[model samples]
Target: MGDASRPRFMGAALAGEAGSSRPSLESGHHSYPSFDNNSSVYALNPEHGGTESRTGSQYFNYRDDPNDVPMQPLGDSRYLDEKRATYAAPRQRSRAKMILAGVAAGVIALIIIVVVAVYFGVVKKNDNDKSTNNDSASKPSGTSGSGGKGSSSNLVVTGGDGSKVTTDNGTTFTYQNSFGGYWYWDPNDPFNNGAKAQSWTPALNETFNWGVDKIYGVNLGGWLVTEPFIVPSLYEKYPKAVDEWTLSEAMAADTANGGLSQLEDHYKTFITEEDFAQIAGAGLNFVRIPLPYWAIETRGDEPYLAKVCWTYFLKAIRWARKYGIRINLDLHSLPGSQNEWNHSGRMNDVNFLNGPMGIANAQRSLDYIRIIAEFISQDQYKDVVVMFGITNEPEEAIFGLDNLQRYYLQAYNNVRLASGIGEGKGPMISYHDAFLPLTQWAGFMSGADRIMLDDHPYICFGGQSAAPISSYATTPCKTWGANMNTSMSAFGMTAAGEFSNAVTDCGKWLNGVGLGARYDGTFAGSTAVGDCDTWTNWPAWDDTMKSGIKQFALASMDALQNWFFWTWKIGNSTETGKVESPAWSYQLGLQNGWMPTDPRQAAGVCGNTAPWDPPLAPSATGGSGAGQIPASVSNSLHWPPTTISNVGGGATDLPTYTPTGAVPTLSAETFSSASGTGTINAGNGWANSKDTAGAMVAIATCSYLDPWVGQGIAPPSPLCSGGARRRDVPLPLITPPPSPS
Candidate 1:
């Protein structure tokens, strides 16, 4: 094992990248000794001229020249390589034999070192690279990747058989037994509404069972309940010291500045039975109606709040029933303020159902919920009103989850008691995910009850990195579709309560500071805003991007139990607004041909499972109504009109209920485009043109829509028919487009 007596040889061997080299036994410098095939016996050759012989177990020294001397005895001496060995060369022939032996030993040692260096430095390094590539595959950029936004747990993927596959992020998936069954409409189920029922059951010979059908719905936002983004004109019309605090402030201001009569007119015309009919005719079957708690209960001094909405609210229900559309009654804005958001009817305070005054507000909310639940549970509406949401988007981070959960239970129990229809037999209760991971609520309302997990998946808001117009539409949806089934398995039901086809943040009024419009021409192919200041000269939404978005939308329709676009209509605006709000309008999408004409058609297009396709479709004009109307409009106002000074309800000075007055008659130019189903100019102006379909529809005008602009590239000319026109054009029979091939 010792090399102290061995001779050293020299050959060409270089250091590797790791700086590894062979060490010579004699001189300080090390090299590989050369091997020769001619000699059989081995001789040890020193760097200096000398020879040493190896026989049996001993080393011998012999001399060929006269001056050569015998070598010192081989022993275990601790001499460093810098110290020279005390030996001289015996002869040239003996030296040659020593070189051959040294070369053979060096060659063997070099092979072993090279192999080890290659294994760790090259092969092992490649293995590490493979691990990194896997990580990027699972966690997409800008997504939590573990599951959803704000999620801490890794996703789990289970193979169909008994195998398990965990992602690099530690998400786990377990194999679930396939149910191999589908839901059929049961006449006995009270909540079935009989709309989707078939006259005869399928024959037992039928082989395929239908999967869960996707629900296509739209939120009637800014209609029954208003949001600043939906109608920024309200904010601009009624200016407050702090700008706008809540709906209460806006209501009081609108009553004072523009008179309660004008506000009433807005409520009457903003959305009507016509809107419901139009929605159904377009192929959507459901509408989520968001309402403020104040809509039902009158605060003592707030004259503007719910002064006349009780009547309109019932009218909405009647319209939905008539149109054969189911309603998801969402109590959007609760008492006090829920989680300090503007949509909660106020901003910057977590009062309603959350903080110091949370319990009191929560009790008040529960009281109203009980009333609404009992009302909707009445025989007439029990079937039409299929879902009741306790609240919308409560901020649980600021308000602890424990408090929210407690409130939910209290509200749930109250609803169940008031409803008298126990859990699954009645309408499904809906609860927002409170921005938690979708999987976090699995088995949430467990046991006997049925409930839906409402998640609002939007990509337009916040500071997410801006993507191409099409990327904004396609990327997020594709990611969601990939994991939808597993994430939704635990809930009784689930729905995307609110989503939009918007791909930009351009409506400056939406967030309260920017140019009037974000994109100038259209949204179909518009890119990210290049200059924050420049507002015009953008590309019109084109066919390719529209097609891409439609494909993504169809995929999303298959992913969730149901989905409601954020809004059905954004009122057309004249001042600092357009006659169409592309980001927020479903009608505009349909008219423009970007939105699918029918959502049910998706099941057929995707080749998954059939949707809830009814044989004889439900009627769009015949259904029972909520029997009673409000007793007194003035009494409900609680505050007197601008002419009177009374603070509280006073019987003697109350104003009798008069009609909300004629709809505001404003002059608007006709909307038509070579690119769109040209604006249908009935004598009643552009109002009657909503039903008309086009490749790019833009007709109505209010605070949302642009006015008098000729459809294609420029504004209408001076000679363009102006002013309030009567219904001259025949009403077009608006029909849903044929299903995609």
Candidate 2:
């Protein structure tokens, strides 16, 4: 029997030889033909000069010997004996030769089959790469008026038209750009700023004239920066966990479920390239990304995952760049909570510019701001990241307005130093309203570079009322529109950073985890307005409900001419398995037919209410007077204010960090193309290497208080105080300019 381990073809060939005729050996001299002759062994017919046309059946015809010699009858005993004697020896040799030939033929056949498969596989791969390149070439880099060089021809389009692209870490996602937008990357020149976000928006290479170009934007909330209302599952897992700070602690103790590393999974999965593409397809141009300070680095036993989100942040930038979406990078949470809110990393203490450790926290915040400014100012990112929100919703009531302004001035100056003093040199510095009136900041910084005031106007959180949704449709038009229009002319460039559709606080965990909503009277001291089921149940919403929400959304769009919707998406509750706060999500609104298909349709929603037309100031449009600040104004708003509100004595009495000369600079994140041999290497995150100042570090001799929990405590000793500039120099109070008559 043939060896079972041998090739199947060899076994089959050997089996065919079983009953075949055998060559006979004549007396004394062996007459068996030699198998070594190639023509005699393999030729179909040696009679016709080793070439003959044979039928299918004739091809398998076999003869024991090449000569076609006949076998003698077995009746002759002498002849039979002679035949048996010679046949035994010659037959054994012939059988061995046939086995070797069959094995050789089987090997050659396998080689041919393997060669064919490999050749076709390589050809198919090349064809796919070529097709991808062709698809990329079909996309337009910019609009007709955009006078910029288009993207490089060699760039292979890995994404566009909902095509799938795998990231370097093997994370696969569909790039959902149905709009006439494309991702532009030229490896030869990484800083080529010539890609458009959409056909309606200006190309990255062109100037974005604020007020002239409408910002149809959406906020990427609850991503990078964790929020209980947005992602309930993360908080619901641990019953005791209230916010990210507590969540991190709880998750750390439970190592069975990946421990603190689970956050990295959330970072990877929560929002992806597809989301950015969807935003673009929805006719949105700008994305406001709320990032936490821990994304840069964590300090002093902080339980947060440090620098992990930075990888995703970089990915966000690339995805935004690909989809032609501009970014307004907002520093959502600071070292200590910016506001004593859960979204600010911690829930209770307003240590940032508020308590005993306020000054120290602000110092660390400034260093981070400077570090970020240096990174974004680089040519690689300046075009994409146009606005930098220095802070997100600081409680001005708790942290005095004067202290906040001083900090803002310091941050502004540091950013200017890191970047240069000129238009387009860096991002426009954005400051939140700090929950204060926009009018209060009318002329706060009259002539101090390119600055913008951001306000978050939301009717949902302003106590509950059982009013019909249609009744509130015109509220935004009458109130928000007028306020924003007035502020634009008064404050140069003002934008509603966040606004949502929900007229009442109704969603699960909308207030916070375990903290119920005011709509159903679950919140403390809040009166019940109506049943929350109607608001939270999106599937049950009727046409009338959708119409009211749509009108309200349109009015809001018109009101906040330059605005970013509160959030682009809202995650579903693990318990419910559906989006509880459907009204707040711009994505859900679009999917449900509540949001306008084209945002421009909202332009004249409020009849006769024209949008604010900005004045022709060089500084406003990043022109000649872009970063020019009046000397008087510059001198008045000095860093390290004369005194902090809660801290005793002067600013010198506040706890602070000493510069350790160890700046943690953010490096670039890179990606390889899925279809071709191309790579996008975002340059080292630092824009200006010369502006390197030592990072802030706690002094060893000083006893520092906990920034998060130790609010309202006495300031540390004098040894703990430093990093303040000219403590003896007392600056004049900042008097706000009168509102427009």
Candidate 3:
């Protein structure tokens, strides 16, 4: 909508050299020679011995004396003999002196020639050596310049400490840290934007050892994926717009007000490079970006803008690289709503896994996952986007565990197939606990690839209580700490994906549009305890309240150990002119003295709680057992399970899309500086080109009920049903290559 004709850079296979590896010093005690600056030997220009000068006048000066004797007169007769003797002596002396002078001149000429010859010989040898090195360094690796796994040889170190690197374009940026951290980017490679989330985090080129490195993170919520509570101004403009779906519809209807095209302005302005810089400045290392599936591509009937958000998503990645932050790319919404929440693009029905089109919806989801995996699994991106959250919060209660796990297994298999199975091969597949207890998923897919368990623990949604805010300071530690520790040992790597300082859900639109907060009982089925003014009006909050909130935040950080606070910020509501959800905003808290300036301050807040210290399993760290899910387990959770609860007949009876060969890959926005722009190959959006599976498309002769709202509808025909054939079974287990020594 906004200058669609603008040159949007797409990835291509280009030639580029791999980056040079840093030189490592051997470990040992060593001593260096000390120099004295005042010593003459070290002086830039030292005094040399003076050379003696010889003149013909000094060798033969005879008659210049004033006091000459007169005896020369008596030598008329004897003088003839004296004169002959004198002349003979002078001639012999002159001849000997001339011989000595000629010999000295010849010796000096010989010395000069030998010195010049030796100096040039050494210089030529050194030049030859340098030429050889440059030739090897400049040779391009057989990989795409963008998003390829290869490093760029064109990288030249421009900083004293080797932190600054400049590519062929002359664009220079710093990477590597005092800790063993570094960034890996070849402007030629989009998948390899060299970034290290923190000084302690690994660069895109390095392996990320989960459970070993902690995650001090915040979620970039309501940015790419819009939320009513997070960005209320957008909704306030259209009173009838309750969620993104309706908001899009309302905006589309009003052509005079810039219409739906106005969304491009929001995407560009909502979050900028400054926000990413501030996040890093606040000492946060990782960010969880919740993205909608529409960012990739949308169908003809869908009202949401298609592929516009993808441009912004690419911008987000580049920004993260600039600020040294890692990304957790979360797929928040799917074809049908994964959860019946407004954040999932709609708020009406749980059609993703609990409706007549559930199987069909899931099939679309798998295809999307596969597409994304192929893109991220590219060598360039694997380092920065370390983790991939396949889904946000699916309502497991509505869709049985078996139905959900089947989808999870298929999604995992698809991702592994695209990216391969290993720690650095692709992003760690993250799964949300679906609001279920952690114990319920303790040993899920025990031997499968790198899987991380994500849980969102919040006390705010439990309704208001008479308890004071100060009393909840230690609540997180008491409740979630031990459980998370156990989950790590029992389930594998576990993280509290979302948590906040709010003890009461009192923010505007926190529940939903027009639905008031539960704190004042405006929400259905809740009793009022106190007025909303106290919680919503953050400006009036006293020091005591701020202290309590700070303590609560610290406790949550300590409890979760590895977590991303619900959000980095809460946008100002157009109607309220302030952030109603103050507690949820990490940026707001930090500015007002509620959130910690440095997240590390939360380390010991829980008091002597021995943190989870168990050694990670081989598979957990992308070692030997990676992607080794047992055949029995994989078969049990096969794609398109034989039956589903909501479908009137077998799951195969559900309508599904055919796999056409049309795939949409994400492209990046290129920047031009005084130096030339660096090119990044975004790739073909397919990770495994060997995988020639077609794109998921609507069947030509079939009709589908509204995928979002169609529930309990019987299949119109058997041909409408579609699913994986026996040939679509899970691929064989692949053992990843050993880690570098």
Clashing pairs in 2: 197-324, 374-687, 661-694
Q: Write candidate 3's Cα lDDT for 609-721 as tens digits.
A: 35677577877877886888888888888777677656676765666666653666555454322123444334445557676666666665666777775466676654532
TM-score of each: 0.51, 0.74, 0.73
Compare candidates 2 and 3 on TM-score and give the better one: 2
Give the candidate order by descending TM-score.
2, 3, 1
lDDT (10s digit) by residue, model 1, range 421-459: 232323567898765546656655454244567877643
**Could you tell me how far off, in angstroms, the CA of residue 341 lies in candidate 1 after the best superposition?**
1.6
Q: Per-model C-alpha lDDT, please?
A: 0.43, 0.66, 0.65
Candidate 3 off by > 4 Å: 1-197, 422-424, 669-680, 717-741
Candidate 2 vs. true structure, TM-score: 0.74
The parts of candidate 2 lying over 4 Å away from their true place are 1-155, 158-179, 185-192, 671-681, 717-741
User: What shift in Å separates residue 252 of candidate 3 from its native position after superposition?
Assistant: 0.9
Better of 1 and 3 by TM-score: 3
Q: Could you tell me the lDDT of residue 450 within candidate 3? A: 85
Q: Per-residue lDDT tens digits of candidate 2, residues 1-741?
A: 111111100000100122221111110111222221111112222332221112232222111112221222311121111122233432233477678887787789777865554334322332333234421212221211111134333334333455565554657766555555555433333344445666567766556778778888999898888887788888778887777888999999999999999999888888988788778878789999999998888877899999889889888887777666889999988988776567788775568876677777888999889888888886667777889999988766556677788899889988888778764478888999765556668877766567888977665553356666777665665446666766777777888788888776788777666657667877655567689998889899899999988988887787688899988988888888988888889999899888987776676666533455556356655667677677776677777766665566766666667665367778776544333445645556666656645667666556678777545567655543344432223232332211111
Q: Predict model 3's lDDT versus the native.
A: 0.65
RMSD of 2: 34.1
